[model samples]
Target: MNHDRSHALFTRASELLPGGVNSPVRAFKSVGGEPFFAQRAQGPYLFDVDGNRYIDYVGSWGPMIAGHAHPQVLDAVARTMRDGLSFGVPNPLEVTMAEAITSIVPSCEMVRMVNSGTEATLSAIRVARGATGRSRIVKFEGCYHGHGDSFLVKAGSGALTFGLPNSPGVPKALADLTLTLPYNDFEAATALFDEVGIDIAGLIIEPIVGNANCILPREGYLQHLRELCTRHGALLIFDEVMTGFRVALGGAQQRYGIAPDLSTFGKIIGGGMPVGAFGGRRDLMRQVAPSGPIYQAGTLSGNPVAMAAGLATLELIQAQGFHDALEASTHALCGGLEAAAREAGVAFHTTRAPGMFGLYFREGPVESFADALGSDAAKFGRFFHAMLERGVYLAPSAFEAGFMSSAHSEADIAATVDAARAAFAVVAAA
Candidate 1:
């Protein structure tokens, strides 16, 4: 592929933006390549600055469930744009969006809108502290709930990609408020609660764990955590930013049959636009500013364009058989890839949960971040470039999950498996 345009663009971006990209992951630092600046995306395909087309599996990191530039969502945004964009004040769209969120996500009886996932997680943590009158919170090591100071103590995603799972700018005092433990470790979670359960304001986690490559909760783990949180009187906060509408319409709460006190949402809801939200029990949500003592504000909190896009996106996903079809496609891709890897003499273990999946170059199950790390990164990186050369796109890092959108059909899955088969051959031969 001709990367002349992408290479030049990266150089220009580095001179202007931090790390040559708006987001760290988009830099392609882990894969050692010039980031391909996207020209446009439609129907699960990304066209790059060089005009190379790729079958996109990242799906803008778990949004675009219905596909990029989906007509319904785009039309909503276009229609709303005619009304002007921001109004540093309330709008009917905001109210309607909140209602849509609450209707679909049962845990969110009341929710507050924010501009990004970071703000949503930060606000949720503050609300927890204010409502419980406590100072500390508990989060899993591999769970990425955006880049809030509390969430960054040992976040996944960008932090993991940079090899700095624990960032430096976060003060030790503030970091002290967050207790990070290995994900999917029930004993450790229980042990922490036993030692400092009384001091924990709340517990936050990505119930399906997309950040560490879709590591799922071990047998009844979520249910146990919910019960423990209740016993200790700490609120359970589910950071469903990646899984909200993609994993299931109601998210991990619906999939695992667990209800959290507070939940954060992003991605699919925005329909490829920028938006984030946090909501849960009506009483707890009432604690946020204008409702109670906790203070949180955003100038662009409920931008009409984003609201219209999100509402339209949510409505599309809520349509009949949306998730069922998405899930079936995801299973075909993940399952076929696993078989292909095995046939190619690759020591690979794969796992899937609804619309999300993890592909590990290992022999056994990946239950935690440490387990995920045991895989061969050098080989996986090689395989990534090989696949990219074949016009198939994956997440930049091995530690991130791959998303499947409703736009991905059986033909897309079949073509992806063919690409994976060829890529695996290259790595296995090397």
Candidate 2:
């Protein structure tokens, strides 16, 4: 467990980067260790700068669906790079990428690609507000929509990991306009809608809730949200940054059978590239930029490399039986983890929404952010270190979800399960 190289790099990074990490969660405060620096990654494996290799269950925060450095994505990026990197102008590849996304995700009739998930959600908020002609937006507790000022309130993931649910710089006026509600509470949702339904411009939610670890919509939850919004004249925005293309080809909406007015997408769509997009009904989307009055634009949004990578990934996903195979692999991995933990006498809870899964060191099931907090985080911390020591990498925090990719082999899944069995024993006995 000699992380001296990582420590040294962290020290150097601190002088230049905030908290020695570009992102807050990477600080590794949750797992109680210096963050390992990645040097190289291949399918299912991450080689750290300290020369340690770990099975990467984090998958670069759920972007590496085809697994790290997929040959197809690499080849596409290389070919696109030869033509050019960024032109700061239109490219034919952008058209192809947009077409691919619109064709796959039903909600996205027209999409605007952005550089990151935060940008996608932020721009979608603008679009929603403009289309609805109202100022207030409602977000849910523990459903992270990105770091935009409006979304920074009561957020999840890195914001929760760092103990800053609401960052300081956001204006109180802006925060006031944004309301935070609890997930899976139809009564709470409708109550708010009744209270300020007309004043509220839109409601953005994570249909499957991945940030507080894969919390699925209970019973008639999504349909309720959709119906309530439509009945109250408020728009429904689905922040599918994690669930999009990972949960299903049509994302959470298709998986759950509820279509949102607007949807934000990221992760696997770009095949490990920096990409995000937001779209919905064509008339609603026409509110953006050149189409209408609402303003949103990007410089390197449709970069040739990113577009090419995304196009290749989408093509592969649609090519004969990919989703079914990916689901079977994910089911095996999650089932094996559950069995291994049980055999090791561990009080662990597991939940999944397709390829994404969440593990908790708790006795009962978790359905909400409050329920997710009931997990034995101390136990999770020890389990994280145990797995990392055994060369099986997991998400650095208990709140983040774990992902299984199509590229993960049966042997890799078995190794991950075996490591979890040993790690569970270590934590349970302690």
Name the top lDDT candidate.
1
Residue 5's lDDT within candidate 2 is: 86
Which digits, one per residue and each the tens of the lDDT, describe model 1 over residues 123-198? 9989999999998888886688887777776533321121222687877678767777778778777887888889
Clashing pairs in 1: none
lDDT of 2 by residue, 40-131 (tens): 99998999888888888889998888888889889999998998889999999989888888888777799988988999999988988999
- Where does model 2 exceed 4 Å of error? 155-165
Q: List the residue pairs that clash in candidate 2.
A: none
Q: What is the lDDT of residue 344 in candidate 2?
A: 86
Q: Per-residue lDDT for 257 in model 2?
A: 90
TM-score of 1: 0.96
